[model samples]
Target: MKNWFVALGGVLGYFALIFLYTLGAYLLVRSPPWFRYLFGFSSLSIFFGLLARTFHWASVAHIVLAESILIGGGTLFSLFWAFFSKKRPDPGGGAQRSPEERPGKSDSPATFLPAEGGDEEADLPVSRVREEIGTLLDAGLSVLVYGPTGSGKTSGVLMECLRERQAGDAERSILLISCSDGMEDYDLLNRPVPASPQEKARTLRAMAREHPDVRIGSLSRLFGDWDRAEGPLRSAFRRAAGGERLTIVFDELNRSSVSALNLILKVMDPVLGHYELFDFTTGERLSCPLDRLVFCATCNMGEGYGQTRELDWSLLDRFPGVVFMDYDARLEKQMLMDLGVPPDLAGRMVHVALALREAHRTGNLAAPLSTRHLKNWGRLVADGADPENIAPCLWVNRLVSHDRLGFPDKDQVHGIREVLGRTFRGGRKS
Candidate 1:
């Protein structure tokens, strides 16, 4: 009877030891706050229990007492450990600093705000943009501005140049070209071409008088015919460069075809004489210049708009700077206000615009909306048209379906509704 009773007690103790070991293993994997204390106590209990039995302690009561003391002490130690392990708050109060600054230091003027908006007091004079045209005369480096639509990139850069020109900066000159096929040719000249020779002369005189330092030209004029200059369109480039420090702005670069893009890369190559020859009238070769010109190109991120073309890796490498233009809520609101949008309406419209963008990103929508759509929508809302009254189904039709601008139909609105239903719940949470 005595031996059997001892065997039973040993079996119980053995099971208890296994249980404690398993618990420790689990605690190690998860390491939750509460488990820390539980593991510590259980481990100490197992250790004391084993020690008491091995030494043949005086009685069951004495063994139990030892186990309890060890468990209690371990629990106390775990509490102390938890206290020390807690993460402390940062000394800077969790403020974000720019990449260039030290952890606690503030950022510089150029780094802190958007490039368009510098410090109020030290803001670069708008007129300096034109003067800086001469600054690019030597063509130190080509610039690439990558931003979403409505980031004020084209307007900001061009406006600054115009401001400089107005300030009497005669040495600087610029040429703006749009690769987009949708833009009208007359738009390039900033007016319609005259039908009569007399009218044409007048237009030319006005252009020279207004923009004396700058000469407005287009790629179409340089090439004469787009289809004919298929194989390495080089001549126009050579003439455009002409050893002058010229700033060339190429907007909507993604609209250009792959072959045209490659041709551009070849033109930009410094090793090759920074110009090319194109076949002109009378079988003569026309040389286009580019060596002394600063090239600035703009492109959109590939977010499902058909306008974007896949850029070749080699072409991407030539342009050193790629600036990402993201949507800034604060700036968007300010821009809306500047456009005569009511403050309240602008705030709400921006929120909806951001929500729609997020929905598209998450695969809840079929197409991405443009900044122009958001601005137009906000304008309509500000004009006293109820947003809810606008057909919910038309969202996709108006913004996503066709490249051309206008309102959407019923089926399009349904698609938008489906997307909104899946992604948003009253615009409060996603």
Candidate 2:
């Protein structure tokens, strides 16, 4: 017990030595600022020595090897601490954007909103999908915004719609729905989570009879039982009086269940004049009144990722308009700038993003660079994260390999460092 106490005292003495040395470093090394770095180096050297002895290092050769390990270990530890703990000039990262900075806020040439002279009746386009839905929205048509995952298809569209909702009438609103499950199937019929097809259909018909103009907000109540009807029925009178039109956003359409697909088919039934559902309890039919709903679905068109399935041409054509949503480097950079990334840094990062996308296209990369990655990478850089470490922390470690055998492609993984070097340092920095 006495020996143990003496050992602990020695350990404390060693730490005290490091602390004193670090304090000296902080006072003396001002040019490059090697304070905590010196502490890390000394601390790691001590650790390496202890580790070597624990492995029974006693011979001169083993002791020499341990000393060599300590020097290399110390250098690595010092450099790592220096990079990880690096501070930025402004912790906020960049200048905040004023209203004048927004694309539509000025008439100056710097303004980069869509060139003027749009149709008087047309709503502004959020993305390419706007070309179809923006012009023909009032025609009661539904649309599918198809694209690669994490491309901002749904988020961008929803943001614009929400913006419109703020200015538009109470009658025009967008609802974000989780249709990955067969939500429409169960909810449309007014059945519980596991109700049979007939029970749901029957309740839907009863609810349909009373509701003249179907409003989107009351959709939840439409699927539950009210004892008098199959599902909870909102006052049809209120819906008619509101005269509200709905735009439904079905997120992750590719992951939707079979039942959801069936409900979608019913929505596409133009001959019915409204979206209708089958009811078994009453042997009657339920339908959304007036057919005033607009549907917008976001999906990944390609296979080999997630639970994506190929849409049949017949079902696909039911969606008269489709748009491919992909990454826009300019918009992404602007978003990063908005999120507090300095302009030059944002541009460099975006350059890397475009380069990565190109690499993915030309088969140099295993996975495509998505907006999500760009945003995360930008934020990390803004917070003073070293791109060398941040790159792997954000994605490399988290990604599943192409073959699912192990790590992602070696060349692709190596390219991340090369990309970061060019992007962050303007070129390789020592």
The per-prediction tally of clashing pairs is 25, 5
* C-alpha TM-score for every candidate: 0.45, 0.55
* Model 1 stretches astray by more than 4 angstroms: 1-140, 147-153, 156-170, 181-244, 272-291, 301-303, 390-396, 399-430
- Poorest lDDT segment (10 consecutive residues) of candidate 1: 104-113
For residue 252, give model 1's deviation from the true position in Å: 1.8
The root-mean-square deviation over C-alpha atoms between each candidate and the true structure, in angstroms, is 20.2, 19.0
The best candidate by TM-score is: 2
What shift in Å separates residue 88 of candidate 2 from its native position after superposition?
43
Q: Rate the local accuracy (lDDT) of all candidates.
A: 0.52, 0.59
| Model 2 weakest 10-residue run by lDDT | 105-114
Best by lDDT: 2
TM match of model 2 to true structure: 0.55
> Using alpha carbons, what is the TM-score of model 1?
0.45
Misplaced by over 4 Å in model 2 are 1-133, 138-140, 158-162, 181-184, 191-243, 279-284, 288-291, 398-405, 427-430
